[model samples]
Target: MPIHEKSLIRKENLVENESLVIDGVDVSGHWSTFITGRSLTDYNDDMQDEIAALPGGENIHRCWQCGSCTNACTVNAVNPEFNPRYWIYLIRLGMEEELLRDKDIIWQCVSCNKCTYACPRDVVPEGVMKATAHWLELKGHTPKSPSTEFDEEFSGQVIKTGKIEESRVIMNFFRRTEQPLAQPWLVALIKGLAFRFPVFYLMRMGMAVVRRPRTRNWAKSRRAINEYVQEVEAANRAAVGAKGGH
Candidate 1:
């Protein structure tokens, strides 16, 4: 498919002449604009497959470059550079270097799912955006995002106890991200909870923190979940050729 978004073209590839004449006709300024072509030498032919191997990217091949994803994207509405359709096109074409141009912003997707709803081919563009972000991290193009760190903390709690302790999750997340727990907002929230909440409820929360409760007979379930997580992690690393531990 042809690229219709002028913004997708690199500035260096676009040439313009201030004064020009062709066949006695003055084609100057914007009229003399031309796009320089370049050959692809670093295409990763397995890019599509690599992304598809990750969760939420399984439907990437269904995309037909309809532009619905970008048109309906919430982030794109605010930031035109966040173009889901254009990224998918680059991924399918194995244009790895071109895709890396937006590595920093690719993780800004808000998981709004508007693009997923607007897509006609069931491409699940929202998921594809997430998978692309994950692929970037796995390929070492970008560092682990805060969202991923939060997810790990949250998921670790669930897998370990079969339940979530909100306080523990927040504290661990803050620690992993190297943020202090004594922020003004957090302090205010704690004060509000202490005064507004019932004494018995507060006592229960404190006991949970001390006891670290787990679901009844959760050992089997935890084992099964841990095994599944390990398998998925291994597959993800293999798919992107990741060498080191996450």
Candidate 2:
């Protein structure tokens, strides 16, 4: 028989073939079915360096994008565009611009940690959300964040009065965010005031948040976060040492 000619294949097809053969048969790699694509720069110096600087960011590489993070995320189930898997992949590719452009989605994360609980690899998507949130804040690009207006108005209220007065927070949050306090329910406000309502709705929650008494453990909470960041720094140092590269 004549020797058969080798068929030419695209690089992606070859990678897909290799990936299929490598671990697609395994139970743990089941999510490999969802790989829309993978990038060439899976890991880069700047990405590794950036992770090294962030608290609790050592295991960013541990994420295999199984979608456990996204599936477990409360926000993603409702908002498909708020994807943790894709952002983690972007970080791995040193796509800092893409990540920066995604501040709104990144900051929308409530950090409830359902994703971390679901992640088999302990990737802690919640932690990554916080680190990225801090990163955006440092870049002075947080104005577009969903919670920015509420946070700013709350801070201003606190600074002015050394305390946040409840009703003021509610009104300021609504005005600053340009949120209509009520639409068809405009009559509901008058009803709530007439009835002395027990709780608030939507953007007005800030009012309730400030009126709550400061906790006795408030100082302890602050100290705990400081120590936690230090520990994360230590862990990052160890991770960088083990890798032995920038």
Candidate 3:
């Protein structure tokens, strides 16, 4: 059997038969394949507004379909399926189903800011990616991805102490994602660094673990940030048709 252009067709929509005979005739080839068509009934008309209500999604409406975001995306270069411009178009058209197809990989963005730098309208594709990923988890469309878990762990430390302990953040991220703390590559890197600069590495590690640094007189600032975060979260939930958030 010959191959067909099945990239544009959804898996469930395609039918194939390598060798088949229909009645008294043979129809065993790529020509015997079928592609089902589907139509969406309801559209989440408020999708753009709901996403824009989030912190990083505020500029999504400014996109003019220049495709710069997708062209400059670091992830898109490796996985063409990770398209920020296409997702923005889907959001603009309220094509929720199409957007959901790429939901799982949306959180894989590395925050390299290449898309943001290349954007002519300042769409900030990085922020839109983060907002979309957050929305997916919030709406139960997907589970908390490893990247999301890492963000929460890092952010939690900063929110609590006004500073982050790198070792603690890494450990907590691995724990939350159920990954082993002693990753082979990470262990190798640490060993290499220690071997090159034993005294410097040991002193730095001890200070980071034992005497964690923090901002001085940060209680008032922390309280202010917490209150602001809560307010924004509540607003975002309400905008997205969710009831409440902590």
Tell me each candidate's TM-score. 0.83, 0.52, 0.84
The lDDT ranking, best first, is 1, 3, 2
Q: In terms of TM-score, which candidate is strongest?
A: 3
Model 3 lDDT per residue over 1-246, tens place: 333668776778887788888786788877678775567877889888888888799999999999998998899999999999999999988999889988889999999999999999998999998888888877878998998788788888898889998888988888888889889999999999999999999999988988987888989989999999888788778778876552
* Model 2 RMSD in angstroms: 12.0
Clashing pairs in 1: none
Off by over 4 Å in 3: 1-4, 14-35, 196-200, 244-246
Each candidate: what lDDT? 0.90, 0.64, 0.87
TM-score-based ranking? 3, 1, 2
Q: Give the TM-score of candidate 1.
A: 0.83
lDDT of 1: 0.90
Clashes of each: 0, 0, 0
Report lDDT (Cα) of residue 60, candidate 3. 96
Flag regions of model 2 displaced more than 4 Å: 1-48, 51-58, 140-144, 152-165, 178-190, 193-246
Looking at model 1, residue 152 earns an lDDT score of: 91
* Weakest ten-residue segment in model 1 by summed lDDT: 1-10
Pairs with backbone N, CA or C atoms under 3 Å apart (clashes), candidate 3 = none
Estimate, for each residue in 181-241, the C-alpha lDDT of model 1 and write its tens digit. Answer: 9999978887887888779768988797799867888889999999998889898999988
